[model samples]
Target chain A: MIINGKLVVSSSPHIRSVESVQSVMTDVLIALFPAALMAVLLFGYRALITMIIAVLTAMLVEAVWLRKRDIFNDGSAAVTGLLLALILPAAVPWWVVVVGSASAIIIGKQVFGGIGYNIFNPALVGRVILVVSWGGHMAGDIWSTPHPFAFGFDVSTVTGATVLASPEKAVTFSLPEMFIGTIAGSMGETSALALLIGGIWLVYKGHIDYRIPGGFMATVFVLGVVFGGGFYGNHLMTGLFHLVAGGVMIAAIFMATDFVTTPVTPGGRLIFGIGCGLITMLIRLWGTLPEGVTFAILLMNALTPIIDNFTIPRQFGGVNNSA
Target chain B: MKAGNVYLQDLSRGIINENPVFRLLLGMCPVLGVTAFFINGLGMGIAATAVLIASNVVISALKNYIPSQVRIPCFIVVIATFVTIIEMVLQAFQPDLYEALGVFVPLIVVNCVILGRAEAFASKKPLLRSLVDGIAVGIGFTLALGILALVREVFGQGTILGPDPDSAIQLFGAGFEPMGLFGQPAGAFIALGLLLGVVNIIFKKFNIK
Candidate 1:
């Protein structure tokens, strides 16, 4: 190919964008900051400590495993580690953070040939393993009461149930509180507002598509109204409650929209999002678990290849006429 | 090859090159079913090994008499007879293991390993070679089961050898939490996959076919 009288010889991907993996990952990390900051603000220093341990452990594990000195600079491991920590209960032990982070890097990413080759989101994989292995710590009464603006205070004094666990609590708890994240839940998943801020930033940066989160939240809203039992004398409020409560916001916005694990095609992304919403609501309604966002995203991640294969757009005039 | 070298190759091949579980992936029923605990795996392995050896010997000796058309039924009959004998012996002597192994002991009649050897090796080879192959492959299956069970038990239950908490072997300290998922069927698959990957890498490192 010739451009401006200069001959260019290259393989496919002839038109290259300025965006690299590092830049994309960096944008994701930046986008995740609002939730991370909210987590620390709500849960205090323990959340900060968990996030640090997770990110450091993930980077160290990847570097040592790959024997790549500059792996920490790439920002993927940091994103994975931060994401894992975000989904964990703020009261979890430091060792849990380390183990989860290491597993995220090793079994989730490296064992599957690393980075783009991995089928599931590395953070969700780690969180799922942690949840399975240590349910007592990851779920149930592990939720700590948020002491917003009380930074450096030990916020682990009071144990509480997430709004999703006790839907009756949603009747008294206003939607504004849930949006601002003054609730008991996983570190980064409590606040719908923070996640939306990050998600919007990501969308604006062109790092993630809006279709995934839009489809996911829409399905959850529709199903939540139908099945959420009309809390606070209104089914629509209950639907909005489902959107704001538990891990729906974080998962729909951040985890399900992960570049490596989610579908690439526009149609496939929407399908993947809807699938996540369906599984999440199914588990939340009928299954034993209170929240199903992690499992839902992971399950959808496994189907990404199939979704992409089916949703691959045909080339212009490529269809057979005499089939 | 020399007689001793041929025997040695036959022994080592089953352990590594043609490992029934990791290599050929034969007899997955018991491999997945009875490998939740170390003792269960050991018991299942021994029972399956005994049946494998007996069946191999009988099938190899009767190979000339057995017609080709009815070979599979004949092989199954021989294998089932051995499996029944082993099952009865375990029930009489080691009832605890018999109960723990449960359906797996009876299921061994259909385990592909025994019939696989009968069809692939025993019916074609001499009695001595068949006996050696049986022992070697049996040991390989036992080793694979033991390794998988050890990983599952130690990680899943924070114990080894037994499922009972009182008699269980504690490898981890009090603070160390057990990964309960490893005790589930899903864990079996993950462990098997990882072990298989490791085996493949080792084979590649040694340039083994």
Candidate 2:
């Protein structure tokens, strides 16, 4: 609209839009806000501090990698930093958050040729690096209880095993409380309601396809109903419990839906979702670790090319050449 | 005199140009396996070098006698003999390194570096040239392993020559938290891969390849 008399040099077959890397990443940032707001409200100022440190570190690391002075560059590093911070415990040491953010940018994003070229969710990569490197800090009976509306109180004082690790902890908090964002989990992943709101926003904006999240959630529910084995009174409630607990909500909503790492075809997206849920349930129900969302998505990310090939559509009205 | 310089080049080639680990990527089995610890990597490198030298000298001496069709099996027998001898020597003398390396010590027989040199260099060249090649390649492999192990150990464990408290020197002091990832098996791959990238950059800059 503004190119009234300008010398415009345009290429063939071009479609214009206001959206860009910055805008899309900004949308993701906006969607992540409710969960982040909920984290600070639930955890305290420490959560806010951790998020800031992570974002700053991620931006700094990416800038250094690109050899550019502009720290925010295209803002994807900020999105990665915030996402990585949200998955970590609120009371985690600041240095761990800094390290995770830096690694997310450098190892996860840049090493593979930056933002759109990375094969795994950068935030999840950072989280997994922290999980593998510092198991004591990342997991175990160190999860701090969330105290909603109390910003000044220390969250680290009250620690307990996550509901996934011990069903008894689930009894201490009701189903409604868990749904409403007051639960002992990661900083941003506790509030299923908040994450769902963000997911709905992302879906409404057409930035994310519903099939990936839908298939992922459905499979997790089915497996939980079958093998979760009445951990919280009934099989169906157990299914619901699995949905809200751990990193399932945040992972299904944000991490699994990563555009670069996931399949591009419509059919392949569903398969990828189902595969993630299956591996996640496998690890949660039987594996030594209480959570498997990060590893599940990453493992499937590694198979994206094969999944895309398998789901490629046949030419219309043509004989099946390979078949 | 030119022939002597040519022989010297043969001895020096493996150190950079034909490096087994960095250049050819041969014997990855041990390169990835034993390079996690400084002492283990150096010991493994030395042990394999010994096997390489012995196997190279013996294989070149017997090249004319060995039948062409069964040369592969003949080379294996020669390499395996030296590997067994080295394994026994390590087990008898350096029990700690033997324990650290464990099955990797016996794994040198299949190490492509030794068998590769035996087939490629020793079998074709004369005994003296073969000996020189062995020394060169052995030094190269040892240097690569030592460098890789040092990188992993310093960052992963925060100490050089660790696992023995009395003589270990801590590089970062008590305030540092070593990245436990570097100590894991996956860390070995990442460290070696990054090292190769840096080496490639240097080689490209210097036009070594």
Candidate 1: RMSD over Cα atoms?
Answer: 3.0
lDDT of 1 at A125: 84
lDDT of 1 by residue, A1-323 (tens): 55578677899988988888899999999999999999999999988999999999999999998898996767899999999999998988888789889988888999999888999999988988888888888888888779897788786676688878878776778889988999999989998888999998998998888889999999999999999888756999888989998999999888998889999999999999999999999999899889998889988998999999888766678876533
Off by over 4 Å in 2: A1-14, A315-323
TM-score for each predicted model, relative to the true structure? 0.94, 0.95
In terms of docking quality, how is candidate 2 classified? medium
TM-score of 2: 0.95
Clashing pairs in 2: none
Candidate 1 regions off by >4 Å? Answer: A1-16, A315-323, B204-209
B94-209: candidate 2 lDDT, tens digit per residue:
99889999899999999999899988889999999999999999999999999999998898889999767876799997988888877888788878988999999999999997
Best by DockQ: 1
Evaluated on chain A only, model 2 obtains a TM-score of: 0.94
